[model samples]
Target: MQINGSVALVSGANRGIGRSFVEALLARGAAKVYAGARQPERLADLVDAGKGRLVPLKLDITQPADIAAAAGRCRDVTLLVNNAGINLQAGLIAAHDLAAARAEMETNYFGPLAMCRAFAPILQGNGGGAVINMLSILARVNLPMYGSLSASKAAALSLTQGVRAELATHGTLVVAVMPGAVDTEMERNFPPPKLAPAEAARAALDAVEQGAEEVYPGDMASGMSQGLAADAKAVEKDLAKYLPA
Candidate 1:
């Protein structure tokens, strides 16, 4: 679905790629943009700068109450961006506890799943707009250092596909955005060649407008996707070099 003239809600909009999405949506002429965050106060500057176009909403995607409340409050929303996520640096086997891994799954996998479940009907009522899930290239291939996070993202990726098929009857466009390391606090320690948050956000929106089911927003993601298609084992072995910490 096109972003222009759309009413959009973006989760995790206080900072990182989520914040960038809020900005890009407004710049693209969206009628309204709901900047959702666990702490709505963190979006003060963005709300102010939105000049009445941006609405700050309290949203902790992991909470059922928050998801329901957000759906009730932002009923006019046509575009839902499920961008809220966490990377706890958890490894599947090497981590001291499963707590961190479970936390990652809650925020990264189930959170978005809940958001989509809550928003699907809203989108259908509003002419079946779109839902964008901010996934990662790692969803297709595990990174041993962040194995748990990768596994959670893979679950999200699978969820994205299933939701796409289910939502098609309603004409809702569900797009999966898979990008490599982005230059956000989430990947601050990662090596160079990271995509800027703004660039990644813009590309994802572009994909939505273009009716793309899946988007690889960066060179790294695009290359990796191609490599995985050609030789999955080779790509997995290459990624294995970055062992768990």
Candidate 2:
């Protein structure tokens, strides 16, 4: 569905790519946008900038009550942007504990899944709206440097595929937006050549308008995706080198 008149809900709208998504959606003429954040007070600036079209939703995708409230109130939402996630920069076993790994899965995997489930009926009611899941190239290949994060995103990618198949009959466009390392605080320690959050958001919105199911927003991500297509083992081995000391 086109964004010009769509109602969009973007999780983790307080900062990073989620913030960019809200701005991009508004620029694309979305009728309304629900900016969901665990701390809605942190969205004061965004709410102010949005004038009247941005609605601040106190939503913590990890919380059932929050998800339920958002779904009930934002029944008009036609687009769901599952952009909320955390990368604790933890290695699966090297971290000495599983806390970071579990946290990453909760926020990056279960959170999005919960949101998708809560909003599926709403999107269906709204004439088969669209869903844009913000993923990473890490979804396809593990970067042991950020092993747990890679694992969580990989799970999310699977969830995205499953959701796409399930919602196909409803005409809901489920999009997996994969970008290279993004230049967000979340990736501050990551190397250069990172794609800007705004650029990724624009590319994703463009994909939505174009009715694309899967999109690689940056050159690095696009190239890596192709590499995986041609030689999965080679790409896997190459990525394994990123394992931290």
Candidate 3:
């Protein structure tokens, strides 16, 4: 959909990929952007850039009240970007911390699920719009460090597909964007070569415009996907080499 004059709401907009999406949406001429974060004041830069077009909303996806409040506050939004997430300190099923695994699900999976549920009617009421859920390459391939994240993303990916099908009748577009390592604070501790946030944001926007159901934003993600598709078990085996014994 044409972003110009559209209103968007992006969760986790205070920093990282979420911040990039907020900036990119505004650059594309969104009439307004509700920048949602646990601490709304953290979005001061975005507020400044929007020059009154950016409205900060307090959102903690784990809380139903916050979800409802955000829905009420950004009722006119035509685009919803589910960009908030958390990476739990857990490993594979064998070495997993059940609590941490559940935390990942609460934030990475259920968070977006709740957001989509809350926003669907809002978008439909606004004449139908789009929902973008940020995913990761880990969604398809489970690694030790990314075990919880992988499972959560996998669930979110399924939700993305289901929501896409269900929302289509209402003219709402639901997309899942699975990008590889991105140069962001989230990856500060575990550095990996990655595409710049700006580049990933650009590709994401383009994917939405082109009606892509799933977007792999960077070359690294794209390449890995191709390899995995060709040999899933083999890829998993190779990935094991990088994990601790």
Instruction: State which candidate has the highest lDDT.
Output: 1
Best by TM-score: 1
> lDDT order of candidates, best first?
1, 2, 3
Residue pairs in collision within model 1: none
Compute the lDDT for candidate 1: 0.94
Better of 1 and 3 by lDDT: 1
Q: How does each model score on TM-score?
A: 0.99, 0.98, 0.95
Model 2 — TM-score against the truth? 0.98
Cα lDDT tens digits for candidate 2, 65-114: 99998988999999999999998888877898989999999999999999
Give the clashing residue pairs of candidate 3, or none: none
Which regions of candidate 2 fall more than 4 Å away from where they truly are? none
Compared to the true structure, candidate 3 yields what TM-score? 0.95
Compose the digit string of candidate 3's lDDT tens values, residues 70-181: 8877779998999999875467665534787889999999999999999999999998888989998888887666777788999999999999999999999887888888
Arrange candidates by TM-score, highest first: which order? 1, 2, 3
Q: How much is the lDDT of residue 134 in candidate 2?
A: 91
Residue pairs clashing, model 2: none
> Which parts of model 3 are misplaced by more than 4 Å?
93-96
Q: Give the winner by TM-score: 2 or 3.
A: 2
lDDT of each: 0.94, 0.92, 0.86
